[model samples]
Each structure stands twice: as structure tokens, then as C-alpha cells.
Target: MAMKSSPVVLKTWYVSIACIMLLSALLLFPVRISLASPAVLVVDDDGFASPTDCDGSDPAYSSIQAAIAAAFPGDEIVVCPGVYSEQVTIGRDGLRVRSFDGSAVDGTPDTVIQPGELTPAAVLITANGVVFQGFYIKDATTGTGHAHVHRGVFVQGDNNVILNNKVEGRGTCRFADVGILVRGGGVGNGVAENNLIENNEVTNTCNGIATVSIATNNAAAYTTIKGNTVKNNLGIGIAADRTPSALVGFNEVTENEIGLKYNSDSEKGLPATGTKFRCNDVYGNEIYDAQNIATDNSIMDAEFNWWGSNTGPDPSKISGSVDYVPWLTAPKEEGCPQKGRMTGGGVLRGEVLFINKTKVSATVNFGFEVHCNNEKEPNNLQINWRVGGQTFIFHLTAMNYAACFETAADQGMPPAPFDTHVGSGEGRLKIGPSPWTPATIQWMFVDDGEPGVGKDIFHAVIIADSTSYVISGKISGGNMQAHPDDP
Candidate 1:
């Protein structure tokens, strides 16, 4: 015995069961939604057709601060080429404020930021992981009779990069006229670390590049200052006060009141250990090259630097307890040294070698000779070389062979090398390579006395393909004289 239902009721019952099963399956397996990438916001001085829309299209915001307010994390703010006269504060994380043009040196499309009267800095950064680049940030204070700490770019957060910008005229305030200031304080999880200040020309301020620790308990460490031309400042070129473990190198610190100053306030503890200074050209300052006013007994390592002389820095030039032993004899080039060799098929083939003997004393020897295949034609060639900060120029047109020695007597070597050459006097020809072949000639100098043990310091290089020419060396150190011609 089976109960038989109407066809319509059976169909309706089947439809209801199917609907319930589908709902159950959906509940068991849920669908997932993914997030999209971050967006870009544009800022232009020209009026935006739509102010609310931040799509970075034709209609953009007039002010940079407005764009920053509407931007999300990891968003880029591309500023058009114009003079922005306002105080810009970036309080968001992972935001980039860059010019539309690549760099300020790229002409025409320049992004300049000039602060108003009440503005403390042209650009102030309070967020982490931010990048501020390619802008000419200047004139911190616009009006007179107002004295507030102003800066070109004031950074207070960690892991930030300030690159390839020209910052100048931050000199209104008493103690705050700094081109680029990395204010040291606690941020987020820890103190500010790994901040890179590179490739910027910072000048005409109280201090060119300064890292000050406002918090006595915590100081900024592991800050790297490299490849920046900091010159002609009223105060110290590069000042590191209360900042520890800072790596400073390859910076042209010249023509400033004080080239480099490292001071630890008595109230603040001594600068942390492992502060290294190397490969910097510290010269032509009005006062001392480097001064260390740290009261503590901690010794800072400022080894391997060119103090504008081949004989190294005088004891009176350095203050406090700085270890500048075994200093370099010539200017250090920016970035890593490149090993170069003569290329291209030509008539002349020659190699130049610089040998340094450091075991006995701080003396370097340079040996360079070129051979030409000419029996009937005059064997005429010129050789120019630099060793121990002295340039030696020799004309080999008349002489069959000649040798130049700077002599150990000039460098106070106990056993002086033979000094018998014609052009051994002080007045010698020192000219850089011509503009045509500016890749072959390099001003090579060594740090250590061991031959081929140190890096080569080449200021300029010129490459030529001609057979008959004159060679001139720009002397940077030592007294060199040309040897008698050999037959």
C-alpha cells in the first residue's frame, strides 16, 4: 500500500528539496574576495575639476597636503612641476612624494617647494617607509622677525629615504637651520634605524646634514651618510651628535666652517660604539678638518681618509680621541672603485701599475711606461704620473729613457729611495684629462703601503686613440723628479 500524491504537489515538493540542498552547500563552502593594489594620487597647482576625486587623472588636487590627506597607505603622490608654497606634512605610512620629472638637474620640469611664514619646514615627514625625492626644497622662513626651527626636509620616522634633492637656505632659526635633519626619537616599535641620506646637495644652512637625538634615552643608530656634496655651510658640514653607529663615507666635506664634527652632549650619553668614518675628502675648511668633542673615553675610528695632504693630518688638526692612523693619501672617489683596462685595437699598448710598500713605511711607488714601434720615426712620448700627492710630468722626445722618483726623504722614510730626476721640484704640470677621451686617464692613489693592497682613487679619466700626444700627471702628494734618459 503506497500513498500517491498529485503531480503538481510532487513537483512542488521536489523543487523545495533542491533549493534547501543548494543553500546548505553554499554555507559549507564560502567564496573569498581579494583586495586590489594601492592607488596613485596626483597633485598639481592648477585647479582640479573635481577636488574629491583622487584618481590621479587630469583633474588633480592643487595642494600636496590635500592629496596626502586623501591617500591610503602605499600610495604614490606624483607632484607636477610647479612651485608649491606651503608647509607639507606627510603623516601616512608608505607614501612617496616625488616630482613628475626624474631629478631637479633634469631641467624645465622642476618641482620647488617654498614654505610660508608659519611653516617650520618645506616638507615634514612623520610617517615610516616614506620617500621624498627630486624637489628643490628651499626658504624655510618667508617673513622676517619670526624665528622658528625650520628645515628643508625634517624627518622624524624610521626607515625613510631622502634622495636626489637640492635643499638650501634653511638658516633663519637659531639652532634649527638645517638642510636635512633626521630627528632621533622613538617611533612605532623601536627607535629610528636604517635611514638613508644620499646624493643630495645640501648647503647654505646652519648645518648641512645633521642627525640629532632629542631623546636622551634613545639615539638614532645605523644611519648612513654617503655620496652627498655638503659644502659652504655656516656650521659643521656633517654633524653627528648623540647619534651612534653611523657610517659616514665618500662625502665631499669641503669649504665649510668645520668639515666634520662629532660631539656627544654631557647630558646625552656618549655616542654608541662602532661609528666608522672612511674614504671622505675632508679639505679646504676654514677651521679644523675633523673635531671630536666627546668627553667619554670612547675612541671613534676615522681611519683611511684624505685630509687634504699626502703626509696625513697633523696632530694639531684633530681634537678629542679619534683614531685616524694610517690615513689615505688622496681623495676617495664616490661609490665602489671600478677595475678598468684599456680596450680597442690601437697602435700603442701599455699598462700602468702603482705599487705601495707599507710594511716598512707609508710610501707608494708608481711605475708606468709605454713602448712604441718606431725605428726611423722619432721615439717621442710623454709620461705623466702622480704618487704621494705629487704630480710628475716628463717629456721623452729627446731622452731615450727616463725614470721619476718621489724619494723617501720627502715622506720621512728611514731608508730613502734614490731621488735623481730633472723635474723633481715642487712646481710641476698638473692638468686633468681633456674632455674628448675622459675615460682612460685616472688619477690613481693608494691607501696602504702594500702594492695593490688598497683601492685606486681616480678623480678623472681620459681615453685617447691617437699615436703622438703629451701625457701630464696632476700631482697630489710627495716630491717627484724625472730620472736621466737611458740610451
Candidate 2:
């Protein structure tokens, strides 16, 4: 009976013993992560360490330029595959070297680094939020006037983000070397965007992915080139010159004789007018082979892009001048191009020939000279005319494989054995009658011939070049005599 102490029940047992000692110090503490805020430094040419202590073992800072010189602004330097050999740079605050496992970089087929063994450009990144990804850089050797300025990823700095890396050997680059050489004052003003630089492949190198502009496009703006496939590169697969205002899309610039090259060294320095090149499939790229063509000036897609050029259309003409059309369901072994691809001589009706260079008078104005390489689809086209022996019963509502009907008919006339039996596919062409013009003519069913033996037998003229004519002789009845003055 001596207990009388009640200071409000000892202030509720001292606040329930300080809430159970703050839940047992939040279940035993030790989760404090913030290496001075946003850190991840890790290097390895064998367990490296520069200013050491980003933790993970430290072998005296293995080397990503000595852990990026002791990292700072949003630090993150993984780097571990090996063979760094070194040319290092990446200055100006902002780091991200990556590759602890995300995989991608080949720099030149798995890291080689020998531009005279080092001092070239193993990987000089100059920062501004730097982000280099994957890895693979090669021999790089240069000297013929900075020998293309060696690059495996030589970005100058400014919002940099060189992703998916795999730069090739520069093959003795003369002076504009590139694997990924983004330039322009203060590192092209940043914003290299999403960055996949995909599949990562490059060769010979003069430009695999270049974006120069030391002083244009008002100091270079938005850069976003997508997908990136660029093969064979001697001059371009993805190039944006001194006028740099890049935004090229999808990216699959094939065979590379020059798939996407836009320049402006001194055309008064233009470019920056919206700049957007879409979809991208860009074919074998010979750009129309005039010895690797130079000034045709379509300057990469003014829109969309397909220009592989197989052409057709314009059947008997009426309007259709080509803007792009050749996908014909795509798959006749995949070379399947056909919406239009026409060229020379065409007149598929009971084709049989004779046009008065004195070759026996069947010249009632039967013309054929097609050369329409499809400016478009010229109304899809169709030219049927089966007359007598029906040429395998004629049935070609026009699918246009460049419309063929050859047997050579204009002066020097002779070529109409049913246009060589339907152009070797052994079909079509066999019309009959009309020696003195009663208007039923078209022939070719010869075999001891004359006056209805097998029936159809005029089979007009439809020749295709390389001159060497002969179809079993005799088609010269002295101008079909009914008296061209008693020939």
C-alpha cells in the first residue's frame, strides 16, 4: 500500500518506451546508400581503383581513366571486359561508361585499341553527362593530316550518350574517320537521345555515324538517329554534316555506296529547317551508279525512302510518273519487285510482223515501242490481243512484269514467231489471216504452213535487241503481191 506515484502515470510510461526504441532501430540498420549522392564507380583491367573506395574490392582503381578520376556528378563507371589499352579523355563532369552486364559494345569487334598502341582514340569521351555503352574499338592508326582523326567513339562532350558501341578499323581513314564521331562546338549542344546504335556493326570507316557542325544549325541542335545498321561505310550510312540538325529514323541504310549522306560545308551553311528522315530501308545503295554518283541531290529522304529502282507502269500512257511503288507482295525469293518496271518493245496481241521496208505489206499501223520505267503505276496496264490460235488461250489481265512482247518489229523487221513462243515461257502469240487487209491479221503457227493447215499464221513482229534473227525463214512473199505494181 505504499505506491502513490502518478505523474500522469509517469507520462504514459515515458511514451511507451520511446515507441519500442523506434521499432528496434528500424530492424537493425545498415542500408545507407548514397556515395555522396548517385554513385556506382567500378573499373577492371583486373580489379581496378583510382581514388578507390566506391567499394566492390579496389585493386588500386583498375582504370576507367582511374575510376573517372574519382567520379562525381551522377557517377556510374562499370567497365570490366578487359583490354582498355587506354586513350582516355571523358572530361567536363557527367559520367556513365557502363557494361557490368547490359551487353553491347564491340568498338571494333571486341576491343582492340592500337592506334599506334594508344594515344589515338581508344575512347576519348569528353563529358556533359557522358554515357558510353557496350564496347569494341580497334587499331585506329592515323596521321595523314590527323588521319581521319581516329574514332571509336570520340565524342567531344555535351550531353553525350554514345550507345550500343562497336566501332571498326577505319581502314586507313584519310581525314574524316568515324564509328560514332559526334562533334560541333561544346559537344553538339547535347541531346543524343534514346541511343541504341543497334546491332553494332561498322567497317573501313570514313563515316559510319558522323554528325559534324563546328558552327552551323546555330551551333547544332537535336540529334536522334535511330536503329542504326550502316554497312560498308566509305562515306555514309548515317551522316549529318556541318549544317547538323539530325533526326534520321529507323535506320537500315544497306550496302552503303552512300545510303544517307547530307552535307553542307559551304553551301552557305544551311540546314535546320525541321530535319526529319523517316522509316528507312534504303536499298543496295548504288545511288544510281554513275561511278558511285555524286550530285543528283535527293539528299536522303525528302520523305519515307525506298528508291531501289526496279520500275514499270505507264501502260499506253495517261498519267503516272513514279513517286514510289514496288512491293508486289514481296517474295518470289524476295527479289519480287513489280508494281511497274517496264522497258522497250511491247504489243502482246497475236504478235506477227511486217511493216513495208518492203518486207511484204502487213503494215496497217500496228505499233509497239514501250520504254516506261514506271514514273508510277500508269493505271496498272493491260494489252491483250489473242486473235486465232489463241496462244495457249490468252489470260494475262496484266500483272506487269515490265510487260514483255519481243520479236523485233520496226525497220530491219523480222521477229514474230509468236514473239519467240511467248518469250521462252512457251505461251501466247498466234494470230491469223489478213494478207490483203480484210482486217483479221496476227499469226504464228508455222509447220509446213500456208492457207489453213494448222490455221493461225501471220504472227507479227516483236523483237528484243542483240541482233541475230532467224525463225525458220521464208516470210517474204514479195510484199504480199496483190500487185504493188507487179513486184
lDDT of each: 0.57, 0.43
Per-candidate total of colliding backbone pairs: 22, 43
TM-score of 2: 0.26
| TM-scores, one per candidate | 0.59, 0.26
Write one digit per residue (lDDT tens) for candidate 1, span 114-156. 8674245678777889988788887755445656665788777
Query: Over the full model, what C-alpha lDDT does candidate 2 score relative to the true structure?
Result: 0.43
Candidate 1 error regions (>4 Å): 1-35, 48-57, 105-109, 117-120, 140-143, 170-173, 265-270, 314-316, 334-487
Residue-by-residue lDDT tens digits, candidate 2, 116-225: 53333667765666777766666545455453355676555555666666667556435566777665444444333222244455666766776656454234444556
User: What are the RMSDs of all candidates, in order?
Assistant: 17.7, 24.0
Which candidate tops TM-score?
A: 1
lDDT of 1 at 434: 27
Candidate 2 C-alpha error for residue 18, in Å: 9.2
